[model samples]
Target: MKRILIILVLVLICTQIKAQRPMDWAFKLNLKDYNVKYSLPKGFSHLDSMISSYCRSDWSELFQYSLINTEGDIAIRFLMIPITPKTAEQLEYRKRLFNLSELFPPNQNYLRTIYFQLEADTTNRIAYYPKAYAKKTFNVDVAGEYDRECKIVYKGKFYKSKVVFLHKEDRMDCFIHYFYEEGKEEKVRETIAKTRGMFRLR
Candidate 1:
């Protein structure tokens, strides 16, 4: 009986180890009175704010935290910015699809804020793989749900990206991941999920 119990314990331990297959590193960011926490896959680390400029562009300027994969040049950048008026108008127009007010006054800002992030990030990433120019594919998900993917090919390798947009009462949260090498889609998804899981209002 004691031998059986010992064997059971060993099995449980092995299972636990297998379940946590991908290791992760965590970090937090404070921006405009909001606290954001997220994790990177084991080989990535947060880059200093001063050196984070490389990830920014005129359209996507509000950077929260930037991370680089230690094993390679892969990177993930987080951004948050206020919604613009034009964006609000588009959202208000879309709301009409559900018989909501074409004026959707209250949600116009909300929708535009999220839309701008999606648009800016998607465009900026395209420039990085200009040579390959593969097909650009993405989906406009429901306000609270996410399921978007973008692909870029650099040199002879393929890079996969997942961009997420979240609209808060005050601002929009944007998350982007670039798997610099080919075949890291699962890892990229896992890292993005871990980061989103740590998001907090305060």
Candidate 2:
């Protein structure tokens, strides 16, 4: 009877170990060259995969993965582009051009308004770990928008959107586009902060 009780206790311990396993992520990617892995945030669910198939645009080629909250009010769209030597050179040239443009107020304003529709409160060059080459978070005023699936859910209501860009030289160039309503900036900021922990490199 003592031996039988020991086996029962061992089985119970094994069952508890399995129950404590980590939560499964909805999306995961392994970049062999970089020796890094990427996973979607823990709380978010995978956005519909079909959305990527139908969306065709210049940036569409870069689309990789996406996630959305249960309420559907908040979403994250990820884009990744491989860095090439020629592209790196072009990026440097663009930086120089931007610097030159900043010397002229009219040119700077024009570029900002036309490209970003940026709002008054913009934060730039905030660093996050595991340390990307550059990181920028900013707000933009945009017209009514649809979700990745092109559904008319958010139509007719203007949106204040947040955009985050993270560039890791020779490894990854990624954009995380965040969509949320007006008063949820604080929540979104917290989510952005969590991204630092989500990505890691060997």
Candidate 3:
């Protein structure tokens, strides 16, 4: 009976140790393609209609549309450029130059090197880091991260283009991402396939 009690206590200690460890994230390709599956989070409302209605969804319009999964701390947004084809019909999001500095004050040295604007599929990835909280930066780089753009080729006229982002943390390479285009299905498929196993996510 004494020996059995000791064995049970040892087993309990091992279980507690395993549970206390942080969960590690290694990027695995469970979902191979970026389909139209990720639209709205459950228990969330579509405010795109309101955004387009009250505040003209154009270049001049100062609004950024985004969706966040409360279950998981991931969010993606697009820069809505009113209903104009010229504004709406874009692959490269060059127009966003006007607003990069808007999110953070111009005086601070910010980074935008890892951004692209082909039909403007802008993505903002937020991942948590347990270590860096006590330091100056708190679980994030490129502070106040947000994006605004439109789905350029939803109709039959455009070639689909996709873009990716890597969060700048040495511990984990996780990134929040998005993509949209019209005719370049093969091109998009190839791009998605390549991203698999390349980056690790937290």
lDDT of each: 0.46, 0.47, 0.31
Runs of candidate 1 exceeding 4 Å displacement: 1-29, 35-43, 51-64, 82-110, 113-160, 176-180
Give all TM-scores, in the order shown.
0.44, 0.47, 0.21
- lDDT per residue for candidate 3 within 1-202, as digits (tens), equals 9999999999999986554332211001221221112324343332221232111123232223433333222223333111123422231244374443333112111222223231233244422233343123323332222232334322233222233333332221122333334444464445444433322322
**lDDT, candidate 1, 85-166, per-residue tens:** 5656656667877576534344344344444435535433322222122111111112243333333232234244455544
Q: Which candidate number maximizes lDDT?
A: 2
The residue-level lDDT of candidate 3 at 187 comes to 43
Q: Give the residue spans of candidate 2 off by over 4 A.
A: 1-30, 53-62, 86-159
Worst 10 residues of 1 by lDDT: 132-141
Candidate 2 per-residue lDDT over residues 30-124, each given as its tens digit: 24544555666777876643343312232224335657777666777655444555654655576697674432132122223223323222344
TM-score of predicted model 1? 0.44
Instruction: Assess candidate 2 and give its TM-score to the true structure.
Output: 0.47
How close is each model in CA RMSD to the real structure? 15.1, 12.6, 20.1
| lDDT comparison, 1 vs 3, better candidate | 1
Put the candidates in lDDT order, highest first: 2, 1, 3
